[model samples]
Target: MQFKILQLVFLFAICSAANAATLNKQVRSLDWWQHASFYQIYPRSFKDSNNDGIGDLQGIIEKLDHFTDAVVDAVWLSPIFKSPQVDQGYDISDYRDVDPDYGTMDDLKELIQKAHAKKIKVILDFVPNHTSDKHQWFIDSVNGVEEYRDYYVWANAKVDDDGNRVPPNNWISNFKNSAWTWSEERQQYYLHQFAPAQPDLNYRNPKVVQAMKDVLTFWLDQGVDGFRVDAIPHLVENEELLDEPKSNIPGYNDTDYEYLDHIYTKDLPETFDMVYQWRQLLDDYTNKNGGDSRIFMTEAYSDINHTMLYYGSADGSQLGAHFTFNFYLITDININSTAQDIANTVNKWLDAIPEIYTSNWVLGNHDKHRVATRFGVANADGFNMLKSLLPGVAVTYNGEEIGQENGEVSYEEGQDPSARDPAIFDKVSRDFERTPYQWDDSTNAGFNTGAKPWLPVSEKYVETNLKKEKADPVSHFKVYKALAQLRANPTLISGDVTVKAVDEYTVLIKRSLNGSSLALVFNVGNDTATVDIAEDVSKSNKIVLTNVDSSRDTGSTVDPSNLKLEAHEALILSF
Candidate 1:
């Protein structure tokens, strides 16, 4: 009997060693971005160092330690280039210089150095689709300079029977009006798919394409890890100007951007080619510079099929972005959404993502409402777990770590260009979510020294700020930190994923490798839920992490065969 027991123990030891080897191999295969945490900062609202009402690069440097503490892998900053602030820095006048409103070029350089010292990668927002009308190239194009005349899309005016010149086509700008604006000096109409002050660049011009490439090289030289290319679907349009089909949506005015289908203007084939070319440029730069891979992340708010195309060609000869921004979590899942709804949304992306491509998850951004506010404060931690453990890159917008909510910005206090039209200001205003970060309960939520914030701060800052959250024994910040740390585990990084709706209101996600696994059981509904996950759990049954509102405690053992979760509760288990 003793001899038989020794042989059995030896067999078990061999099995354990083999499983450990498999876990190490899987962990070694992942790239930096795979299973990494990314934090997006809207610079103007992050922090203000000089009490200038606007956040700046200097302010970011002061708070750089925050990301280090949070275990973030990268930071993506919105546009900081010289601009007239027409679209809040989307209108770039100079791609190389930092706008005075944000900071000087030296300040940005200092920020990069400090961020690097903390082992954090920096990504800048690249606006290549259009430039500020005040840009030197646009100014020269307006003057009809021989070499610059083709820098922008220009068309001959269409003459009606009354002899009055009209726009070349029925194209409408996204800002809500005619897309073409006539220039008296050029004697032609210029295409502005967005705001009139932000004219689209003519990619048909080879010189223009190379000029943009040069801009990318300029930033790559500055040591930026990558770029978040904005509005990639708008990079190129149909050469032959054509009127888009009407959307025919009820109640929307004809002047509204939603009045017409955007077939001719967005998601053009050439736009994908443009993205591929930029990807090539980034790849070539890394080859020559001998550093970490510089990535290109494209932003295309198109349908799922169109958005996936931004990844690369179907044949896989050309690669576009490292990973296109995934907004399904932000757009599809809501407060009242069911567990099946969440499962379907997750499956939609996992089904569409190319086997060769990586995945990304975005919960909120500057343009959208805060997740806490959108899905209810109680659900914030639950969703964060979903985003963090999803077998890919997880992006967190500023103030998300502390469960910040949308601020109250009255119409009169709104500064977003989209809110300029008073008639629709209340409906389209983004100022509520773009308010200053709440650091403490002090004035302006401690974002600045004294001056009023650019937008109103949320009044809930007293209990919702980082200081308060960090102090609480059970808080969003604590849960977020635990989730961020778990991202480095081999099981979470490259393990096989299984997601399903355990019930109508609960989701069960399992990431397993070898014999070890991590499981997330979340109740997204309003009522309590009892989930039997015995089939999903393995030998170890420890609760690793729980949502801020969970009644359960971490490090406790529980029977996966019968688990009870309160409403809006999420628990991560290790087995």
Candidate 2:
């Protein structure tokens, strides 16, 4: 009864705050991500000044206008926190300080202020799941200080149901290794759910949750608009030390393909409560200046259907967005089945989740190959159109506007673990995903002047650079700009989504807010497929945008039986 009452009170608070979230707080010419299109920068590969050969925080500030090249409303920088750089800055050595390699706290403050001046809010990466081994907390814990020791999960051995089990527990790390690592100094196996260098924090401990909450507070207090919570689901593993028995979820990923039953660990019920607490913190901070709280979109390990629940506030209130539409996951393209898969997965959440203040969407990130490369297209215009036209707040990764393909990296250049175990990794290639941004045809593709880029720039940089594309009005950059700018139009961002096939080769959608409607036609085929619109759409409504075949001649042969579309193209129509 106490747990039930506690849960009810928490839910009540979440609902109340979520209702507040809908207040539609606008930030200096920008709406709450509704009128905004976000662009993600790897930071290291965005730009480099001082010829330091690494992209610095100052470099990002210098090149802030570059994102304006694509009309993005916000910029999300991958982790620049003090780190050992083991997981490319995902492992934070310190929470409050900026990494010298990136720049200084002053530089970051300047970046935020400057971006806000451009009407672009800045969102930083928050890695609450784990910390770098070098973090003071972890260092102090190894000293057998019971205070910090319980801050992380440390086990002597997993008590197996059978006597002869080797690992004691079958739970495997997403990075494909034993979840527990032997810490010689502590003389106990500590949980390193990712790499030995990155230790997972035990959120089951009140102090652990409070510590992470403090981290969130530190950033929000610094005027950050939001956070992209990294690996959110793995924060609290089962205390019993359980793993997936390797039953049915096959072909989903090789990352969890090993023989470990994860039933007793991961995706625990408390995880949702943790997100609630984080959401509450975000909510309180958002209301700090009498505005909506910072967004709480998490990259929790849940699949499409499971993520919607995260959007719900802890007290049955609406949580912030939990959307992640990654191209790396759906690299395979088929006209009929892929279209259905896309529609089903997306619509599932759109229907299931409430009208939360935020919804999740993405094109590419640092962890996957460029969307252009993933789509097997030298230019990913068709796919980008498909992704952006979805009825939600969409995010485009760096270099995606120009259809940046993946750049090649030698063994030394690859910073991700997925790149390390290439044999085990089923690569349509994830390494291509982490290549340096191709900004211009300049010596280093406009990323840096130094000979050795941290990662090589795409050779396509010559044609893909913003300089050339800006002049060629038909560039993907322009298309994305148009689509992004329309997010503020009320219909696209806050409309009811109705996705249906216009035909076998074309998937059609309607984003309707009130009675005003916008219908998008995506021709995912090679041949021009005719789509005859027999719906309420009449020839009188103006066609707002066209991506596949540019001519939006509604009066010309676009009837129910004769509607047509070109191959691998998408079109958005608003009335």
- Candidate 1 C-alpha lDDT tens digits along 448-504: 978988788888888889888777666788778867877767677778888899988
lDDT agreement of model 1 with the native: 0.87
lDDT of 2 by residue, 1-575 (tens): 11221232343333234434432342123346654577888888888876677788988988888777567777888999999888889899999999988999999999999988887889999898889999989998988777897878887754455863244555677677677787778877888778888988888889988888888888887888888778776767777775556755556543463455465565566776787777777767666666544775677556544565566543555454444333323433432355566666556656755554355566568776666765655226656756665655678888888777778766655667644765644463355677777767778987787657776776677877777766664666666665655555544555567777666667777766555666667766667787677674555444455552354432122444466666776655545
Per-candidate TM-score against the hidden true structure: 0.95, 0.86
Candidate 1 TM-score to native? 0.95
The per-model lDDT (C-alpha) reads 0.87, 0.68
